[model samples]
Target: MTDDTETDSDSDSNPNQNESTDKQLISGWHGRYYEDFDVGDVYKHPFGRTVTETDNVWLTNVTMNLNPMHFNEAYAAETEFGERLVDGTFVIALAVGMSVIDVSVNATANLGYDNIRHHNPVFHGDTVFAESEVVSKRELESRDHVGIVETELRAYNQHGDLVLSLERTPMVLKRSHAEPSAAEPPGWPEGIGTQPEDC
Candidate 1:
């Protein structure tokens, strides 16, 4: 199979290469460039994360969602679910996050999300698995260096119930002159999004 990314002649493929003299090559694992995606490609993302109590409670507080069923066990046991519910927002966030490495890690910006659905409730301690399918892609006249990609994202519980779904549109960088996205999210300048120092 052909590799989609640029190959650097100076970069070493050997893990044992001299650390000081060798530069790491951009990897497909980090994310895909605009050219790498195709319509109808479905990606079952690799990472699965279990939701913790801290993840639910802290997020519920931070987002100002005071629903008792999420953080209060007493109120939850009386309900149909019979347990503290993991906030739906957290499920959605996790779904989006899971898609990032495969769908948007090299993206310039997330334009928007739509057609969201909460098909089921997620309970704390439930492991969430994510999957995404590329639905569409097109080049933008306004941004010649990038293209728009639309994907349908889904999150499922360990029992295989679909919990969340959404359609996301992102401006993905073209491989022509693109650089890897920042590994650290906080250091991006105000207008320019995070740009990794090395690609």
Candidate 2:
């Protein structure tokens, strides 16, 4: 029988130095170069965070939220489905943060979000994971170093069920020698749509 195991330079077999795999597990942005990302690309975030009852209660009260379903357990118990519920805003905020590493680590500003939906209720004990899919990439008309990128975020529970979805647009900096985009002109620029002022 022949042994075919191969050894790497950093492997434990090199006894001169003792090192652990901690460095390997350190999680952060992958820093994928500009040329690497493309439309339709999908990235799943690395970490799953477990929601706690304390988190929900704190967020609900601190935000001065008026939703009874989120805080008052007794009030919720009398409702259609009897249980304490997590705040919708908390779930959205947390889910967006969860996807930041894979979606916006190099972003300049969050342009805006569109079509946000809470597909299901997120419970206190449920664990959440996030994923993003690149929808489009367009060069800013006057900006040389940054481009607008649109992405869709989908948050799921540990059981592989989607609980929320939203689309966001952001300006992402390119890793190049070009100068950063200058601040947009003070007033609304041409060709941009506008809304009527409230009477």
Candidate 3:
């Protein structure tokens, strides 16, 4: 006699259940593996964020970054640009953070950045966005379960102007199911770094 209600654990009868679970697992960066990236791979963050006047003002004050170029329009008017400018550090932080959902959310450690260039100044009311391109990947010599990823980070404004550029390095797990191990890679290397061969 067979019990019709007894469900087989590996049975394909409940297709929706397995499908839904798979969708949930891959929905966020948490489950992404180093295998997900390769040279020339680019991940434009899923969404763009608008920068507000409050954002600029509060960030400037809270961080104690009271430079006239960022806070005092009257003082800035006396300078070459003639208006207050958004802090460069603010632009860098916000832009990089924007890309976390697609890049570093599953990363082990932020190795470092290189060839940082402030191409243009960001101002209040200017919305910023970021796109990261994976420029290089190397398997750790000692750690079989992780890899080093180098990325070229570019930030742009709503006006389609390049505001900043840099190379970011992070250690990412080679496989989501791999066991955790003690593997630490060195920080940014010295010298004329290689540029990402844009494809």
Candidate 4:
């Protein structure tokens, strides 16, 4: 007796059935391995933050930006903006920080950013969200365990207007190949976990 059935090769393969190098992720880790990224993939970051007067002023003053347009509402009202402008560096940092869970949670280091541009002004009370798309990738020449991933990062305001855009490159460790942890994998040290004897 003989029976034949054709199976589609494009069907999803179960990791348990196949010999995959990827391992089950531990709890609290939410990042992709280098092998997971694909060109043209888009990740919409999961948070939106509203800029505040305090946020702008603190960031501006701490960074030594004495520009009145950022902290002085009265001075800004005299200008065409009609209100204080949110510092551009603060906005960029917030945008990129929101993307950490999706983009670089397991990354080694950020290489650099290029072609940074501000398209529209952000002011107090304006909410912003970020999205990134994979642009390109390459294996690092000097390193065999990591590859470089380039992405086009974009931030949009509540009204759907593009506020900023830039290209960021990060060094990512491959899922199949990564450098072994140096010490105890970056957790609690020796006697730190012990409860206080007095308590």
Candidate 5:
């Protein structure tokens, strides 16, 4: 005679069963590895960011940009733009930031940027969106587990005008080499102290 019902000891015997259940419970956007990309594939990033007057003024001052067109409304009104123009660097930074979730979330390092061109001026209250196309990819000769992916990034304003464009390269890990455990939150180490006094 034999019992078909699974017992506690039977479940405990297979440690992977628990891990499988945990993986199923934890589900969301995990980002892409090197193998997930293909040349010419374009990704339209999900969110749009609105540039405000405060944003232009703060970034200009924080970076020590002495341009009046970025912060001084009175001075900017005298220029051909007739109003304050958002910092070009700020527009570039925002475009790159928006693409990170779709292109470089799993990347180990950003190789560099190239061919940056600002086509149109950005102003306050303008909403910006970004999209990226995988331009090229190649496996590293020295590092077998790592590969380089180059993408062409483009930014557009609310009216669909091209505001900026650039190409960037990122060093990404291959799916075969990436650590699966990294996807899960780490547990507290046994010997590590949680309280400041214990340290």
Candidate 6:
């Protein structure tokens, strides 16, 4: 069997080297705010998650789903699919989780989900990818620091088959309110919290 794991050579060579360097440390992606969205813009989320039998079984069990088709192999084999099917609700949850980085990482609240539809069955070992398109956005007259943004979310299997789709509305913070410093912890003086001994 081939090992497919990737490694960074620089980090492997001198992991502590970065701590001594004076290079400006830039913040990583915190996701987009309200002004970053535009109607008709499509965001193809970069990550894909492979669903496994364990994933389906565990989620179904935890959620107290009594459906035989999801866990009982013998029962599922007798069904039309002839195999276990991943729970539909798990797929929906996974799809929404996959879209968070691009669609609602900065959202203060998820307004609601609408038009949720499951088009096909998701089976174990199927890798799922998500994409979202900005459907509409509007400023809220009642709130100056936040706005509503609607997006059409879609999920596809490894073979590019659409498995799930839905519309999500999130109340995202406006750029004016999402200041760069807002990423820092509240009420903790910046320099005072760095050393572990300070605690």
lDDT of each: 0.83, 0.76, 0.75, 0.82, 0.86, 0.88
Segments of candidate 4 deviating more than 4 angstroms: 1-26, 178-199
TM-score of each: 0.76, 0.73, 0.71, 0.76, 0.79, 0.82
What digit string (tens of lDDT, one per residue) describes model 4 on residues 1-199? 1222223332344435556665342334437768889999999998799999889889999999989999878999999989889999999999889877777866889999899999999989999999999999889779877888999999999999999999988898887664323221223353453233413
Better of 3 and 4 by TM-score: 4
User: Predictions ranked by TM-score, top down?
Assistant: 6, 5, 1, 4, 2, 3
- Put down candidate 5 lDDT per residue, 1-199, tens digits, no spaces: 1344467567778868755432223334657789999999999999899999889988999999998989888998999999999999999999999998888877889999999999999999999999999999999889988899999999999999999999999998887876544224123343443333332
Weakest lDDT window of 10 consecutive positions for candidate 3: 20-29
After TM-score superposition, the amount by which residue 106's alpha carbon in candidate 4 deviates from its true location, in angstroms, is 1.7
User: Candidate 1 has which clashing residue pairs, if any?
Assistant: none
lDDT of 3 by residue, 88-179 (tens): 87788887898777777567788997899999888777878899998998888898777888999999988899999999998887765443
Candidate 6: where is the Cα deviation over 4 Å?
1-20, 181-199
TM-score of 1: 0.76
Cα RMSD for candidates in order: 11.2, 14.1, 12.2, 12.6, 9.2, 9.7
Q: Candidate 2's residue-wise lDDT over 1-199, tens digit each?
A: 1233444534557775665643222223345434446999999978899999999999989999888898888999998768888888888899889877767766778999899998888888999999889998888779877788888999998898899999988787776832222221123353344322211
Worst 10 residues of 5 by lDDT: 182-191
Best by lDDT: 6
Clashing pairs in 3: none
lDDT of 5: 0.86
Better of 1 and 4 by lDDT: 1
Per-residue C-alpha lDDT of model 1 across residues 8-126, encoded as one tens digit per residue: 43344555565576444333354688899999999999979999999999999999998899878999999999999888888888889988888987787899999999999887789
Error of 2 at 176 (Å): 0.3
